[model samples]
Target: MRRSIVAAVVGVTALALTGCAGGGDGSGGGAVEKATIAIAADPGSLNPITNATQAGQEVSAYLYETLMSFAHGKDAEGLLAESWTESTTEVSFVLKEGIVCTDGSELTASDVKASFDYAADPETASPYSGVYFPAEGLTVEADDASRTVTFTSAQPQSFLLSNIGQMPVVCAAGIEDPASLDSTPVGTGIYTLEDSSPGQTYTLALRDDYTWGPGDVTSDTEGLPKTVELEVVDTEPTRANMLLSSEINVAEVGGTDRDRLESGDLFTIDVPARPGLMFFNQSEGRPTNDLLVREGIAGGIDRDEVASVSTGGRGELMTSLVSSFTAVCVGADATTSLIGFDADAAAASLDEAGWTVGADGVREKDGAKLELTFVYPSTEAQSVVAGIELIQQQLGEIGVEVTPAPSSSYTDVIFQGGDWDLIWAPISTTLPSTWAGILSGPFPPDGGNWTYNTNQEFFDLTAEAQQLAGEDSCDAWTAAQASAIGNLEVMPFAESTSTLYGAGVEFEVTTNGLLIPTSLRG
Candidate 1:
């Protein structure tokens, strides 16, 4: 999800180095005394339940603990819950012993139940509730004596284990006063919010008793920084400058600045992402509703050129809508055969669809010109604007007049107003099954079928996939992706690889461009 950036702050100078210190619990030795990282924006909300931005989610990953987590790759490993079992319509998790919240309260099954219940409540209105608690019957029951939490769904859900496991859990305090959680977040994780200056800076201190991290991550983990600081530096150039000057240890840098950073002594990590997709408004009364027009728009743009310009030739041309990092179904194998860059074919398709080139070089049919409004969010990341401009130029070649619309409030404009011919937003998820929610339903909030587009075959395949668990459902999911691609319902271009440059620290990025806190080392 896109994060909110309030105001850009001036860059900081390097601080004097301090001696390495042990963890809060005196566990590991030879850890970083202190460290600072630059984030592109303010998280807006510290609350994990309602915080949908990538920045918020990244920060919250440290403050909140999930039942299970993605361990380096797609494998789901235990975090709060040590072991879990799943049936067709229900999943049960056994909580680890001796887990405690930051407030000195024991972490129990009741806390887990309360967290999920709050998110599922309609009054709470969490954006992630539908995704995390997707079961139709949707019931969360906790056995305090057994220290187990079980979720029961009315209908069969193949992705139940993953969906429930990935959700961030909150303490009873956060569940009771959800409103106050916007600024003061409380959870059981590796770090606790120490101090904050809203849009300028925020700090987190390591938790002494945090031993329930996913995989082998724990408070005693070697090379874990004692204190972490997040400074808001919205501009990419400034972030790159800070990293080069040793003012900040790590920051995500892109475009031309990335070349300069890579040449320096900085260590870089690249995580794959779906750079952008052209979402056509398939609702009635829109010109792009026609299949030929959608196909023409898809075939006109060269994915390679766009990827090159967007990432300064560092990104890969997308073969499918789903990222390769996704565990389920590596990628839709039929993507190459489904979509390609063929300007001649695009023009021919438009001509066949009754749109002919007029005297002014724009196509027109029935006194209407083939003009499209391409919308994208305005951010410091240069690729977003550059990619949209390339798309405009590419579509113009096929007799389509493209107008670029850069909006600060992209979600409001696209989801609420429904105001554009094409939107350049990519949906990134760890699991391919997440697409089931994104591709389903009537429209937004409920599901991401914002275009009001529908395919009976695709829906049927996805439904079938949901009936089975794990790799057993891979075939159906692959078929669903193929059906969507063949129909040109969603046109994905450029597989974005985010590169983060660090001065003295080394870290790995998750698929969604989030740094794994436990992986950071001095």
Candidate 2:
């Protein structure tokens, strides 16, 4: 619910994505022909907190390990944290002991403490650490010989286990210079960052000593590749060319180009989960304050059309504010089902509120045009274009004028005080508990969501949910879920599905889900 706009989760360099006209023939995966994979986009700063950019998250996944990981089960091929234990209230982790950084330091409890502390500290300015570590006792007291960090939170949070699974734990010592850690990842995963020439490419070397990997890596020993590399192939056409010419081993191809990648002999199309959505401003005094109007907008958009503009031509329409993984979303489809692709119903509801379409073809009443200038962060060209266009089409049908305002460097602008109507941006969150820490906590007048869409009722519910320490607190959390979605303040969209293109090769490769590169073999 933070106002930080994102045009789309589009890549920067070689990982150009465009949906193909049809589904892939499904024959491109096998035998791991190449270890090096190229993607598009120059990853911003390597710092996990500073690197809010898409590439930063991608590389961060490669170089860091967390107490737990989100990419597990069928989706996550496996990475750090072998398994975990959950009580009604707290989930404890038995670390993936013996994992070490390139600096040769064995992964330990103290390192976990340092990494967790680094994220929570306001000084580090991590855009998202608050979501995972919500408790006070983040200290790591380890058994000198055991090499395991027993991670315990203040309460029993069902989503806490998932949150830690994706967080990248860093070595406080190795990162004496944060810039170095950012430029190169010295992780316990299969691959370590070797070199990065911004705007062109990035390269990685397979860590032969990598002992720990995702659970399903299925290695006899510490199986790995001779080397691994990532390229930042900037444009879509350029990335497709690289794939066809075998200039790169794997890449991401979406939209129309998706057809070419699926049709080409060079690469196999990998579909990770791609979630699309529109985020409403939570600032006070906005029309979003009107629950009916909010519901009307939520019910207005045609998710099928929105999905059509996205990468795979197929996207799961979200009815809840949270993704399908969260508990609140599990049993609460009742609230969500009320709002989905019903422009006729939306129009009727708006008419009840005296909002009539004006001569300009925009809705209006009380002298205000239904025209709302929709804003989104100009992070990437493809994302900006797709997000704005789809939103425009969806809202335009309801006599809503959505003007696309694009800005390449608008991180501050998006979060800053604005006169915006609606914006599309997702704050990266690993757990639902983060709802309290990021959304309600910072998005109002006093916090980061300076959009003025404050709702005290929503904030109090979030606070109440945070204090309860275990799964027993599900009742409170479920309430928060209903309040968030039912209130229609921030509309839920999609979980960004990232993709990976690869040649006939053997390794656990994917776009957005989970990664276990170290366990992969050439």
Q: lDDT (CA) for every model shown?
A: 0.73, 0.55
Count clashing pairs, candidate 2: 58
TM-score of each: 0.85, 0.74
Q: List candidate 1 segments past 4 Å from native.
A: 1-30, 73-75, 122-125, 215-222, 344-369, 415-418, 445-448, 508-513
Specify the poorest-scoring 10-residue window by lDDT in model 2: 1-10
What shift in Å separates residue 400 of candidate 2 from its native position after superposition?
4.4
Among all windows of 10 consecutive residues in model 1, the one with the lowest summed lDDT is 1-10
lDDT of each residue in 1-522, candidate 2, tens digit only: 001111122221112233221113322243343466665556666777555555666667666655543332234323455555654345555566567777787776567656766676655656554465553444434543554555566554455555555567777564555667656565565556777787666677656676665553423343244566766766667777776776766666555555556554432324334344455665565665566677677678765666555534444445444444332324333244346778899888777767788887788889987767677655443843685687788778888777887654344454555667776654443245666555544552234444344666666776676665545555676677566666665665544444455544323433233344543443
